[model samples]
Target chain A: MKNKFIYLNNEEKISSNQNKPFVYLDNGATTKVDEETANIIKNNIVEEYGNPSSIYEFGLNSFHNIENVRNLIKKKINAEKEDNLIFNSGATESNNFAIFGMAELGLKNNKKKLITTKIEHGSIKAPSKQLQKKGFEIVYLNVDSEGFIDFDQLEKELDENVFLVSIIHANHEVGTIQNIEKIGKLCRKKNVFFHIDAAQSFTKVEIDVKKQNIDLLSLNSHKIHGPKGIGALYVRKGIDLKKIIFGGPQENNLRSGTENIPGIIGFGKATEIGFDKNEEKVKEMKELRDYFIEKVLEIPNSHLNGSKDDKRLCNNINITFDFIEGEALLMYLNMKGIYISTGSACSSRSLEPSDILISMGRSYEQAHGSVRFTLSKYTTKEELEYTFTCLKESVENLRKLSPLTPK
Target chain B: MTLEYTKKVIEHFTNPKNVGEIDNPSGHAIEGSPACGDMVNIDIKVDDKGIIEDVKFKSYGCASNIATASVATELAKGKTIEQAKNINWKDVEKELEGLPQVKVHCSVLAVNTLKKAIENYEETIGIKKEAKSIEEKAYDELKNVVNPNTGNMLVDDKLIKEVSIKEKKIILKIDLSDEDLYKNNINDEIKEHLEHLFDVIEIIFIK
Candidate 1:
């Protein structure tokens, strides 16, 4: 199923299913490229193969097309004309550049402290740790049991020495959406740079960079049904970021890399479909997510992980079942053709529970029992019903085999 | 395409065999814990002449844990007590066609739990190690019971608040929270360990 070259032609799109139902519930991991976006990518590959930097009509056309997608993304994010988007390999590089690029300026300005929450993705967390080696004080704000970062802690941590307050907009594991507007206003008031790792929430939620006062926003493509290896960092035309990745002065002397023409076009097309306010698709996702949660919680001793209200992402359903390991539940679901993910340590090489759940005050057992089913725009009621049925059977059967279950 | 696990692993994990508890079991054993992310509890019913009648298992682990225990229980169901103890991790792996290297520990846990269940039964019917004093007997019997807290011997932890043996009776006071997640595990461990060493085990939990 990990066919990287499946996009080479249309015939390869049909996987050998033997007619078994293939319910994809791991969209938080990555979404399948929609037909429109895939077609765009294929056409861009075959027709527009010129490098954007070449000095000819073909190259000029490619360069203009890249700029057109950039303009489209700017409109989608609703940034001012002064704001700029720098394309990169994905959110990982964008998050790195947003952090390390600012750290260089912060070092000269005596802003040695950086602020972030414990639940930020690894791109943020790992770089924060690296900065610590360079004598940068990184403060991790705490979160409540529902995965809400303490706003008061953020306010207290904001000081002249703090350079960046990078937080994940929607948590990848539990789907808890932070109050980004409030966070932006606080950072803007303090004149501190506020960055958001919006890889998981960029298209799922409505984001206005100017209204939110976001300084740097990390956006990715594959999570929103676009091709992978392409993302953008929206710089609000103010923060002077030192070039961490130095090269031939491409990306307007900001980020130096050859333009990924096809990737940029796919990102633009996917964002057009995602950020165009497709309320019907979003409503279906919300309804199906709620219905799946309700049906799954009908099983005894099952608890939802994140907020049950509008604060949570519409397509994310994370639940913890008592007396069962999340990895086992995932296996059972996989057997039933329900592809999902888990927070259990046994399935990981490090053997540590998810930091997002642990920071939310879930014990090791509770964290290990967590399962996340992230629906996509294509997810349907029938798929959810089948998932629910398989989920109930797995939990019941696995709980019977769990030593933690009372005899 | 097949997953890293073999077909038998997928089969056993999907619909495991003999995955439950045996009420009024002749011997019972629990291994590992939830904090470690994998735990196995095996119960056995043995007939006369040391022949295993029925065996069942419950797991708080992953696919490998459940499948390994399922296969181990199936292998131990009708075997004699000695043969059941000989059912090692390698045999479980071979039966499952092969477990991933990371999941090899799961097979070991299942086999250890099964062997411990048989050993507990061995002690119950006066077929285990010789004992001198009540404390020594209790310690020797419980020496193999892994601590649910630290994955060490249960005797290593300060759970025994007080212990006194009057004739054949062993009065033991243990300090454990009433709401301890592993309370039942400790109880099962105590009974499995002390049942052969003493005619009576008077357990009093200190709140």
Candidate 2:
């Protein structure tokens, strides 16, 4: 059967006879929404235009749609309870709430320590810094060169005064999936709060809140091919989280704002579709990823940043090319109609080395020279072949100009 | 045809001249900003006639910095104490082809180090009178000048530690640790301030 999963732009198909558009390799930055999910969003915007907060029948209809979507996500992730899911702007906001809310809770209980790792995204690091300034003792757990957190060090750092352990499910830069289930079990045994920023791995991996013992989980819709500007935080029942933003009573008086009904519906649909397609997609992506890795290894001085065999996300591949700047290589690839991200998209312009890689014991130079390639369900073997060709050419061209490379 | 820099200047950058230290030279001058990571040290030898016969520099920075040091040495070689004082950054930049706009200050570090070497050379020759004259000249011009960025007088701004005029080029060596001067727009401010005083100005930040 013809693969219906191949990505094609409707606008391009209608306007031109081009066989292929740009090969987008920057799925880690943001994936294009599936056609079905896109249709749901489009239909909501076009027809269901009423605000969910309004008192009219149309508003009621939108409100019911919001609840249905929430329920769907609740069922998909198997959250402890339906009310535990609280919607926010995106994963950044959800992360902020998780960190700040936990800190505030700790403050109320006279606990002043927060435990986290050095490799977390800036969304976690920035808030952790804020908490440190606010008089909370912050302990940053270190990671090894392969981006694996030292669980022994974590155990030593955990104490009675420690408030929360916030970590990313899988690193966005190097694609190292942390043992959240093991970490969660430890946290539960210690009676400590655990929060996972699952933005990169939420839909890609199976996450059972109870199985993992996750107290709080943050997820972004955009990462799963849902609408942007919509995400949710799962705050376990009986956990008292202090509200960061105070306004009109909504979201059980936790997050107060006019609900984004259409985006929420799209997020819900994406979540449902993601869980359904995950098993088959995972098998396919792993095959493609392994093949891509095999081809990439042929290039000299190119190295994988994370573990080759483990519980890594099937779609993520982070490789570092010695003697070449990642940003320059990315720009060259973009000119050739291949899109990929170098390090965190949020901090790409800052020229700062990846914190995740640094914590993993990589030098600043190695961290700066790394590029991430994240695939989606729609990614095909043909695209992978084209990507390898473009990458080989780009690396050679970049090395020619690099001062560090010898002739 | 690209640019005709002195062969010595390009040679020093490619295979630098007088690399490392001199096992306790008569005098040592170390200068550069940590923010910029540009540093230079110069050592000199003087003969009985109070003429500078030898000059060597150990520089840590970009390509322009090494070229500047090599050119400064060529300009200072065999020059009497009186003649070396007139060497300026413009002369160095001109001698070493032309530095990129962002790296013009590399030339300044070379000029600054040469001035420090001269000071040490004069002291070594026991010419106390000439040393005072050189100090007086540097002190006079730098005293009234203000760092344009901070709007504070150069002497009062505390960023500048020493200033010398050599060959119509004024070299101002600054201390980067002086918070009020090197923070934010201060570099641009100081550059603009120095432009109005002399036809060619060079600044060396000594952290």
Candidate 3:
């Protein structure tokens, strides 16, 4: 059921169920594009096909439309007028630009240290390692058993040599929402640049760059019902980041490739529409997520990862079942047509367990058994019930067949 | 669309053949770890001519573990002890078409358990190695038989009160209620299985 494209005229509406019936719970991995966003992308491809770089009437119109979309995104995030949004392929590129680019800028200023947490996404973690190999000291702040960042450790690591402190606003795997406002204020006080990877939290949570005092923020479209391959990195007026890719002066010479016009327009439309229903969407997500968790925990020897008392992304639920492997569980769920993810989608293929869980002091057994269920605005109660039934049956069968008895 | 596993692998995995164990098995071995999500146990009954009369396996893992073990038992059954010992994991992988690169260890688990069971068989009748006392052999075999419902061995369940072997006859005193879910056919299955393992005239299962 992958890579199946449908061509629809303006009169014909796009439906998600056209291809097949599936209970998709991997919204944290990526969300399904809404009808409005799909229509915008289609119209952009069919009617507004002009290259914005060219000097013509259509090109000028394209350029104007792009600016309008950018403005719409700017308004959605409630950023200051001085802030600039640099579009990129997605959060990975934005994170690279934030981490690697800042590391280079830090090196120029004789600040050879970068600060981050062990629970940051691989996009940030990998770039941090790259910087580490280049002789820059990368300090990974520890998280408690509940996946909460140690503010004391952050305070101890902050020094004049520390140029950038990059943290994720909402972790992709465990769904723990960090205290970015406090972290931002601390970074501002320490005169260190703060970058927040808001890929999972952008549209789900309220974020104001000025109010949060965040210097650099990474936002992606696909995680918010927008089209894929389009994201934005919000940079404050005073902070200057070196370009990772060299090209023409597009995106203020930071990201210099031809813009993804259709994706950008779809992102704008998705954001605008998503914002219109933000409160209602959050309520629905919380209800579904809570109901699912309550039922899932009723299974014996199942435990939730990360903090339950603190704030988490409304749609994310991560749980670990003792004596069962996450990959096996995922396969069983996949066979049942209930598509969910295990651990981080990026690292699930690897034999290694989730680093995020390991960093939170969970044992390898716990980390290996972790499964993530991320609901979306489109997810319904019927889907949740179906997923629950399939999950229970799969777990019972797997455990019965498993050699590892519960301790 | 089909998954990466072969049709044979999927078939064996989904509806595994000869699952569970042989009571008072002539040869038995447990290998791999459920922590790493791959564990298999093989039990074999050897005939007087040193040929594998019957083989069964129980595995706790993904499709690869279950399929590899199922196919391994099929390859070893009815083969001579020497021939079964020579059946390597690569042969099992080949018989199942193939396993994923990461799941190659599952084939290894199947082959190791099969060989270990053959080794245990050889030691039981003083064929190729030193033989343990009959009581020790019976204890080891019974200790390895895991309960499919609870995943614990019978010894861990504290169900067996007495185990005695006289000549070629083995008697087991299992403490359980008739209303137990595993009660129906419990005595008949154990009697049939142990009779093959010891080459005995009969087995008495006393409750």
Candidate 4:
């Protein structure tokens, strides 16, 4: 059967004769929006163009659509009680709001310490560092070689001074899923606010805020086959987060800006689809992941970077070759049309090796030679075969020039 | 010739030449920079005319680095000191087809090793000259100077193999057996009392 996602690429072709199959394995960066979600975004912008803030009949209809999407997302995540869901540009802005806003609110009380992991994405790490420069003491919990945090150290570090604990639910590099439930419980006991950067993990992994004892969560729509430039921050009921941007009191006074109505609606619909299809998708992805992992191991000196167990995200398979540069491998594979990521796409330009791998006790050399292959439900066996073929040749070509390799 | 090397540097890297080391050699020098893993040691046998008749090298580093070393050795063999010293990195890269921007440093390592080997040879020559001058001076000064009790000059009593001079101090390398010395008055006798005898100063024990 032809892949629906590949078929979407055909529809993307401007002319009928220009269609070509492009296997996209970089879904961890961002996914191609599904047809339904894309249609919803197009219709909302082109036809339903009423300003949500306006009180006229047409404006009221648009406002209702916005509320409907908000409520739909609220129900999808099982956010009990009337929790405030504020829409933002993306997870970066949402993360900024959660950390900086919370820090701002807690400043008067002298609760200034922020606890987070060493392997968090730049969106979380950047704002946390900014907070640190502004007099907030930041404690970074170290992750093990498998990219899981040391809970013993975390328990010791959590104390009265910590105002917040912000961590990514799943690592973007190695796909190690953090134990958010235990972390959430620990935060609750310490009375410290816990914020999850669920950009990569939100729709892929199941999350229940109340069950996990989560206080705040940041999510991005583009990561889950929805429109870009739209994301939400789930602020638990009774939590007081100060506004960072000022102008108008929209999003229940939590976020003050003109709401991105169409993007939010698309985000909500995408979340709904994800929640419904996550089970089947996870099963299919696990099968494809196992196949890819098994085949990749046949290559000499090839090893998986993350956990082999179910604790890892089913879609992610980060591999390290003994004597190859990640950039060279990525470029060679790209020439073959097998798209993949060397690390987080945002930080790929730095070429400084994976911070997540370094945190996991991988040597700088190992981290530099790492490549991340994240799969989606749309990925097929044929794509994996083609990727494997290209990868074998690329690694061989790169290793031929490496001085570290033995004859 | 143009100063810039040709693109052949990359080709040499892709197809490296003369990879391993030779068995035995007359002179050998190993140099490494801990900052980077660039290491090269060359062993050579030069003819009376100062031509490098035979050269062998072992390099542990990047491809460009190793290739540069191999190419540098090949280029240095038939050339005189003047020509070898004038050898530029561009020539090494020209020997190889081309090199990527990052791997250009490998070629630099090769060039640096070539310069180091020449410096090592010159340093060896200086050491030899200094040693010969020091021996001549010591032989003239200590010819008749004797141990007070044994009535023998310290140099006449033993064979010296090596001598090193630093600042105002002289260190003599000698091979001696304990049975060659008589126990009685060994410390207070000849060598001990010679301190007051002449300008030939400080004797040391060696094995």
**Best by the DockQ measure:** 1
In terms of DockQ, which candidate is stronger, 2 or 4?
2
Query: Model 3, B95-193: lDDT tens per residue?
Result: 887665445556766887898888778777776755578766665544433333333345547777777677777767776655554443344334433
**Model 1 over residues A12-49: C-alpha lDDT tens digits?**
13443566678999999899998999998999899988
Residue-by-residue lDDT tens digits, candidate 4, B1-207: 001223343345445555555455445566543112345667665565766667666654444455687797888787776677787666765667544333454554465566656656666656343444554665533332223223333455654556665645555544443344432223222232233333444444454
> TM-scores of the models, in the given order?
0.83, 0.68, 0.81, 0.69
Q: Per-residue lDDT tens digits of candidate 3, residues A196-231? A: 999999878778887788899999999999999999
Higher-ranked by lDDT: 1 or 2: 1
Question: If the candidates were sorted by their DockQ against the true structure, best first, what order would they fall in?
Answer: 1, 3, 2, 4
Stretches of candidate 4 above 4 Å error?
A1-21, A344-353, B1-207
Model 1 chain B: ten consecutive residues of lowest lDDT: B144-153
lDDT of 4 by residue, A1-407 (tens): 11211221233353343444467998898898989998988999999889888999999888898888888877777897589888889999999999898898778668898889898888888998898888889989998888889999889999888888898998888889998999999989888899999888887787889899888999899988898999999999988888898989788877888889899889988988888868888889988998999999899998899886577888899998875556546655654567787742111223233778878887655666778888987899999998898888878766655545677
lDDT string for model 2 (A305-385, tens) is 887655677888888787665654665565456778776221121223366776777765666678888888888888889
Candidate 1 CAPRI level: acceptable
Candidate number with the higher TM-score (3 or 4): 3
DockQ for all candidate structures vs. native: 0.26, 0.04, 0.09, 0.02
| Model 4 chain A lDDT-worst window of ten | A1-10
Q: Estimate the Cα RMSD of every predicted model relative to the unseen true structure.
A: 9.4, 12.2, 14.4, 17.7
